[model samples]
Target: MGKAIELNQVDTIYEGEKIPSLKNITLHVDKGEFIAVIGPNGAGKTTLLETIMGLLESKRGEVKVLGKQLNGNGSNIRKLVGYVPQEYSIDDLTPFLVSDVVLMGRYGKIGLLKPITKNDKTVAKKMMEYLGISELSNRPIGKLSGGQAQKVMIARSLAKEPEIILMDEPFSNLDFEARREVSEKLTHLHKTKNMTFVIVIHDIASIPKVCNRVIVMDSGKIVADGKKEDILKPELLEMGYKGIAC
Candidate 1:
């Protein structure tokens, strides 16, 4: 198996910002690896994930996914990569159904104007079932709880059958029980489907047990990267989290 993702001496700066949000981010993630990114607020965790997804253009260096460099062809790369942003909100009166929202994931592969296939619908429902949200398929996305909504997003990401998924704060706004459930679901996907996952999480305790590797970012730089056991040590975590138990 080859590398699933690679960042070589990459630097990305947001518009109007003098300092790059990601600095010298040279890293390689192999296929089938489950990686957890943890750090304090403003640690550039989100920035790094966005760069990998090609959502944020890099100021310098190269980001390659699935053996292709992400340049003007980001949309092509996105067809193979599923991404769940860190923040998403639904208006109270929005009429989009849960199934519709999930089916949208297929748009990256099938195109927006093209006809939807039976296989696409089947995949969307199957993903919802896998995430234990099948019963809510017909419900309005705006009506579901935060946890349920997050699950929908995950299902949507899976609906595309992506080779790799990049999720930012997948467990945010959820209670402990919801967090555990989601973590277990992700573990099942990793083991059964061999889908690579790179998740950015703020809660240290929320890091899934299946994630063997952890990458720590601080001040737009990768301060540390190692096994979960080593990087989760308070001394090492303190460098990014300031002993605050992030």
Candidate 2:
């Protein structure tokens, strides 16, 4: 019922970089909140999410997620948070099957050393159905197209049964129809399960209609945060970005 994530004046720097990738970022996300983070290239959108997940160690200030501090043994906290990265590399001929990839999502909850149980497989298959990819279960993952592969990744994340899901540029590879479908799917999950979502996206057109809050970032700083309608003002396009927000 409290904040799901909190960051206070946090600064994150990449090794060998003169300037921090994230600067003075402060944010609090409530439980069950759906947030859209949109910005032009070079914004710290990715860095901000990474910092909250302890992927980017904070150079200064504090970060707490689900009541756990960012520093020290964050594995337990990570198990509660699902992250779908921007890109993952796999050989075009990789032998891994779609089911295999999705099944790995359960490894966190099932534990690294334990064998997967029947319940785990059931959950993974349900996730596949939710993503409309159940037919691909036996197919080789590398055989799928860009949009199909993205759905597989999302299903994989959901198999973990995470309380909060963080997605980065999830709609980048999808066609317009695919993007809208996936957006609606996310909205359904949020509505039914009260799931918390913070998605980093470039295309404003793809922002799920269910998202009530939006955060805008530029030059490693959060330039604006408020109701989705208020933050997407026309003038926002003039700041940092060159083309349409979508």
Candidate 3:
């Protein structure tokens, strides 16, 4: 596999904090690989994702994506990447439909002052269909359940046609069946689309089903990196995540 993303000795410090959120973090992701970043709370998982997305500045080291340097702004880099946040906040009473939110994914490519074209609408509709949410396209985003809303978010991300997709705790609020369905859908997409995926997940059990590689972080550092069956051993799980591997 060819390298899709690389971080070398990356470090970041939030305002007014003496300690850095990330310390000397280095990793490389291959193209079309499904990688899971797993860690306990305050382990800098969010910070790492933000750094890759160019939402936060790196105080030290370099981050390269798609063979190009990520200079913090990352506007050009972002064009090839899609992000689905952990939570979706919208007013229940708002009139915006699910399709409307999905269409927003095309805005970055469409540019300002240009109206959404037929091709953009077609793409958004196709993404919705791909996610099995075509029936909910006309529903209000705020009225959807947690799982439904998450599906919409995933659809929106896919509509961007990005080479790399980053998801932050997408199944955190979902029920058991919903979680399984979403995981399977994500796995299917990754395999069929040949896209690189970097997901931040808290559950150890889900990692084996969703990711090919597992990265364990603790105290703002990567403690272990290997295949799921290798790194998810009982001892490593207890030591790094302080939880059962289940």
- Candidate with top lDDT is 1
Q: Compared with the true structure, what per-residue lDDT tens digits does model 1 show for residues 1-246?
A: 899999999999999999998998999999999999988899999998888888889989989998998868478788899988888879978899999999999997787798999999999988898888999999999999988999899889888899899999988877877788878888888999899999998877788888889998999999999998888887446656322111
- The per-residue C-alpha lDDT of model 3 at residue 232 equals 77
Descending-lDDT candidate ranking: 1, 2, 3
Instruction: Kindly indicate the candidate among 2 and 3 with the higher lDDT.
Output: 2
Where model 1 places Cα greater than 4 Å from the true spot, the runs are 235-246
| lDDT, candidate 3, 139-237, per-residue tens | 999899878888888888888888898999887777777677777777777888889999998876555365789898888899999997787778456
Candidate 2 per-residue lDDT over residues 97-171, each given as its tens digit: 999999999997777889999999999999999999999999999889888999999999899998899999998
Candidate 3, run of 10 with poorest lDDT: 237-246
Count of clashes, each model? 0, 0, 0
Off by over 4 Å in 3: 208-210, 235-246
Candidate lDDT scores, in order, read 0.88, 0.87, 0.83
Which stretches in model 2 have alpha-carbon errors above 4 Å?
A: 71-73, 235-246
Candidate with more favorable, higher lDDT: 1 or 2: 1
Q: What is the lDDT of residue 173 in candidate 1?
A: 74
Model 3, global lDDT: 0.83
Worst lDDT 10-window in candidate 1: 237-246
Predicted structure 1: lDDT: 0.88
